[model samples]
Target: MIRDLEDEILGCTRCSRLIDYIRKVAIEKKPKYRNYQYWGKPLPGFGDPNAWLLIVGLAPAAHGGNRTGRVFTGDMSGERVYRALYEIGLSSSPKSESRYDLVELKGVYLTNAVKCAPPKNKPNKEEIGSCSYFLKKEIESLPKLKVILTLGRIAFDTTTNILGIDGKFSHMAIYSTNRLTVVASYHPSQQNFVSGRLTWGNWISIFYKIKTLYTSHNA
Candidate 1:
């Protein structure tokens, strides 16, 4: 299943023009960056085949997921996320370095709204719209997806739009739509880290809510 998804993504030129432009700029700006080599390749999705929990993150970090082709890998955001997953009994391993390390997810699947790395880590609306098809397909492919943990406003908005939900952002009001529990949280970007906006305890609190919500949904 994963192999097929990768093949489809690699052959996809639906957004080729935009991808090409982004690649050109990334390469020209950071020639030494390894992400430039695989910048054009389709990003990979990870986790259980029947995952009930789906994590929607922003586009892959230029040097992190974009370079490794695995969501949340080789990045600080991933480090904190995986640690929490491990603590919450959602991951088999604490380390999410790469697929080669046998890192596996349990009952949770991870993906991004935009598969490709956007310039400056921000994907414009046009680019997000262009990649919506893939996101739609992924959501459809998962037969047991019941919860979505959106890691920022962009991710929250995009995932909600894809799921056909209509509402404004409310961190306090955890809503249920399309048979999914939508949990919103701030993106664990470097900016959040340096500014001390998302501390370790606060991050864990979000995941704790996810655990409780998911458990309630299943019950």
Candidate 2:
């Protein structure tokens, strides 16, 4: 079922603007990674089928995920995210350079609110609404999912809307309901890192707290 869902997501063209942008990005190519072929297609969820933790981000990076075909891969944000996951022994590697790389995530699933990369890293309201269907379907498919970790305000807002939950976006904020717990965090984007808003010490701390919550839920 997951594989079928992924295939459907890859073929989606719900948002023409996003579809065109990804195609243009694929053809133009980043100067440094010019030799490589870009994925350019809509990204789907990536991780264990029975994952207990769901990590949601705003969207794929044009040069990172759009190029490598994996959310959070081939980007600076991915570096910090994986590094922190590795610190907590949840990731096989500290870097997510490629989807085909042996960087496995244990007990966690990774996905984005918007499957396609939008220009300037921002997706308009219509685009977000169109992608919400896929997000909802993906979440429903995960039977064991117990918690959602949303990175960035957009992701938090999207998740809340899709799940019909009342919440606010704030770094390290936790919200709970009869369904799943939601933990909000600042995105591990370049701006957050450069501004010292999300340092390694604090970034990894988020995972540690999640680990405890995850274990408790499992128990």
Candidate 3:
């Protein structure tokens, strides 16, 4: 099933123009984006198959997941996020290198809204909307998705909207509607790290809430 999904994603041309633009920028303007690799390849999902928890992020980081081909791997954002997951016992392994690395997510599945790496780490609204079908299909494939942890406001809003939920954003608030429990948190971006907005303790708190929600729902 996952393989089929990946194939479909690879063959997708919904936003071909946007992808072309990204590829051009990555290849032609390589000198400008020193932090990221401009390999111009599609992104892939990582994590457990029968995962009950789904994590949604904005898009692949240029030097991070985009280069590594696995979601949230080889990036600063991933480092902090994965570490928090490990500390909270959500992740099976502490380190997340490649998909075949010594990393495991027992009941967690990770994916991004956009599969391709966008320019300057920002995907336009049209591109995001075009990629919504894949996200919807990914959610549909997860039969045990009881909790969804959205890493940022954009991911939170996009995932919830895709799930057909209506509500405003409130930090640390759990939204439920028989389908799944939605939890929101600030994205573990460089800005958050530099400004000390998302500290280790704060990230752990968010993960604890997700674990608690999952436990309570299953109980």
User: How much does each candidate deviate from the true structure in C-alpha RMSD?
Assistant: 2.6, 1.0, 2.6
**Arranged by lDDT, best first:** 2, 3, 1
- lDDT per residue for candidate 3 within 1-219, as digits (tens), equals 665787788777677765685466566644545665554566757777788888889888765665566888877888887888788887876778765587877888888888887877778898888888888888888888899888887788788889888867666767887878988888988899789987878888888878888889988
> Global lDDT of each model?
0.77, 0.90, 0.78
Q: Candidate 3, residue 4: CA error in Å?
A: 1.8
Model 3 — which ten-residue stretch has the worst lDDT? Answer: 29-38
Q: Model 3 compared with the native: what TM-score?
A: 0.89
Query: Where does candidate 1 stray beyond 4 Å?
Result: 1-3, 21-40, 170-173
| Residue-by-residue lDDT tens digits, candidate 1, 1-219 | 544675686666666654675466555545566444544455757888788888888887766776666788878998888888999998887878764677888888898888877767778888889787777777778888888888888888888898778856655346688488888888887778789988888888888888888788878
By TM-score: ranked, best first: 2, 3, 1
> Per model, how many backbone clashes are there?
0, 0, 0
lDDT of 2 by residue, 1-219 (tens): 667889999989989999999999999998999998999999997887888889999999999999998878989987888888888887888888887888888878899999999999999999998998988888898888999999999999999888888888999999987868999999999899899998888988999999889888878
User: What ranges in model 3 sit over 4 Å off?
Assistant: 21-39
- Give the higher-lDDT candidate: 1 or 2: 2
